[model samples]
Target: MEKPLILVTNDDGITAPGIRALIKVMNKLGTVCVVAPDSPQSGMGHAITVNDTLYCDAVVVDKDAPQKEYRCSGTPVDCVKLAVNEILGRKPDLCVSGINHGSNSSINVLYSGTMSAAVEAGTQGIPSIGFSLLDYSLEADFEPVLEHVEILAKQCLEHGLPTGVVLNVNFPKVSKEGIKGIKVCRQADAHWVERFDKRVNPLGREYYWLSGDFVNNDKGEDTDEWALANDYISVVPVQFDMTAYQALNQLNNWNFSQ
Candidate 1:
């Protein structure tokens, strides 16, 4: 039996420590091929570089590493499209994205480049998973989450994902022993309350720094936020379809004619 062709990507750029950690674990699973952004595309939600010349270059980061790698000057979604359409030339057996430097739990999934890559793969009928740690530091330790990532990736490869589904895995920032375990959960209801910090530059010009606090309003025990709070690696099965089918008939009866 041939080794599964595994497509790996991340929003944190190919050189980011998070992707390096992801690559290490993926190498154990199968033949890994990476097509990730040339630079960080952290909050780029399913964006594609359409109006510009997109390019991909073969790069050797870790000369000792076994898998072939390429850096793409595009968004996370673009990387997936390029990989499937141009690089791989055939759909990969599995696609795993991230080991991201920050949490992509709850509503954050909507804006995450990490999850976008996996979502792109899922849209193409490929089994996919996105991994993230709660820590956002560039030097955050990932040793503890490696085993969990391996387990989830292997399970996805073996059992396969349901059509139109992708896994979103988020780990709490803690040690290996501190992690309780894994929980299959739903996305928690959350929102970011944006705030702009007004500041003055050296030239006395005022500027605003983008800032926000994540507010989780969901109290459901089965939510990803709850799982993370309890020190568990939360795995939420996500889909791209955003239709509110239940409200379709309700909206049709609204007083639009009046």
Candidate 2:
């Protein structure tokens, strides 16, 4: 039996420690081909490069396993498209993104480049999972979640995911023992209220630096935010379709005749 072909990617650049850790884990599971951004593309949403020309270079990051890595001058979603269309030339058995430097739980999923990569793979009908550790440091340790990530990856390979769906997995930023078991949950209702700090430049010109507080309004215990807060890894099944199907009839009943 052939080893499963896995396409691994991330928003935190291909050379980041997070991606390196993910690549190491993925190599153990299958024939891993990494196609990630040349630089960090975090919080880029599902952006694509259209006007600019895209560049993909084969890199020999690992001396022993040459030709297994690629750096793309594109967004995370673009990396998936380029990997599927240009690099692999065939659909992979599984697609995994991130082991991200920070969490993508709750509303973060809407802005996460990591999740976008996984969603892009799911859109292509590939089983995909986006893993994130709730640590934001450049050198954040991923040793704790590695086993969990491997387990989830293997599970996805074994059971396979539903169509048009991808798993958003987030781990707590603690030791393996400090972390509780995984919990399948829904995305928490949350939003970041932007509060730009006004500042002055050296030339006395005004400027603004983006800042915000993460406001989690959902009090439900079954949400991803709640699970993470309780030291449990959260797994939320996410979809690309953002349609409010239930609101269709509600909109139809609204007074639009003027």
Candidate 3:
């Protein structure tokens, strides 16, 4: 039996503790190759560099680490594109993104660079997963979720995922024992209530800083938001297709003969 080839990436920069922790766990699984952003690209959603030049440089962030690593000067999605097209000689068995610094649950996935990378891999028929923790702190402890990460990755490699689907896994801020269990749930109907704080610099120019509160409107117990709130790790299977199948028939019934 041969060791599986795994590709690891994240929206957080290559040197971030979150990605470094992910790399440590992946090394135990198989041959690992990392191509992540050189700087944090938190909210870049599936963005690819078109007009600008992209750079991917092989670098050694940790001497003891076994994985071949590259720091990409582009979005998380761009990293995946480059890794698949240029870096890796063969297709990877699995692709894992994140172990991100903060949550990408509910509607946050729409803007998350973490999930976008996984989604990009999923688009290419790869078994992919995006992992996130609720903690926003740079020094947040990732030790608790590492075991679960390994378990999920192993399962993904063993069973494989459905076509056009990727897993979005979010961990609540809890101790290892504090976790109730894992829950496969649907994405919550939630969105940000945004507000901008207007301020002036010393040059007398006004600027606005974007800020928002996350609000969950859905009361469904089967939602990812509910699972996380109840101390469970939430796994939501997300698909790349944006079509609304239910609306197709309704649109067909409309009068267009004129």
Candidate 4:
């Protein structure tokens, strides 16, 4: 049997240690192809380069790097689109994004380029998974998530994902005892209590720095927040469909005939 062709990508440019670690692990499972950002693009969400020209160039940073690696001058989503539409000779068996340097649990997924890449792949009918570490450090240890990622990726390749859903896996920063295990859970009811710091720059122009604290109000033990708090890797099945089925019947009663 031919080795599974895996497409790897991330929000954090091609050389980030997180992606480098992910690529290293993926290379062991199959033929790996990477098309990631040329520079850090954290918090970019699903934005694509519409107003600017896009560029993708072949590059190498490691002696042990995958044979097919391209750096993209676009968002994480754009990389997936390009990889599927132009780069790869055939549709990849899997698309894996991240091993990201921070948590993408709960509402963070809305602003995550890491998860966006996987979400884009899922939309394109590819089995996809996004991996994240709770640690926000650039040098965050990826060793803890390696086994968990391998198991999940292998399962997806063997079993395939349910249509329209992709996995969002997040690992808590490793402690002295290391990661406990995996927990399949739902996203917690959470929100960021945000504020902006208004200040003046050197040019005397006012600017604002966005800041916030994540608040989780759900006490449910079956949520991603709870799993991550307990030191287990959390896997939440996420779907891109934002339609509210329950609201359809409620809105249908409104008078619009006039």
On TM-score, the leading prediction is 3
- Candidates in order, TM-scores: namely 0.97, 0.97, 0.98, 0.97
- Write down the lDDT of every candidate, Cα atoms only: 0.95, 0.94, 0.96, 0.92
Please state the error at residue 15 of candidate 1 in Å. Answer: 0.8
Find the number of clashing residue pairs for candidate 4. Answer: 0
Write one digit per residue (lDDT tens) for candidate 2, span 108-190: 99999999999999999999999999999998999988999999999999999998899999998888899889999999999
Query: lDDT per residue, candidate 1, 102-191, as tens digits?
Result: 999999999999999999999999999999999999999999999989999999989998888999999999899999999999999999
Worst 10 residues of 4 by lDDT: 58-67
On the 0 to 100 scale, the lDDT of residue 232 in model 1 is 90
Candidate 4: tens digits of C-alpha lDDT, residues 1-258: 999999999998999999999988898899999999999999999898899999999888787655589999999999999999999978899999998999999989999999999999999999999999998898788886787789899999999999999999999987636778889999999999999999999999999999989999999999999999999889999999999998999899999998
Error of 4 at 77 (Å): 0.4
Cα RMSD (angstroms) for every candidate in the order listed: 1.2, 1.2, 1.0, 1.2
TM-score of 3: 0.98
The local distance difference test score of model 3 is 0.96
How well does candidate 4 score on lDDT at residue 190? Answer: 97
Using lDDT as the measure, the top candidate is 3
User: Is candidate 1 or 3 superior in TM-score?
Assistant: 3
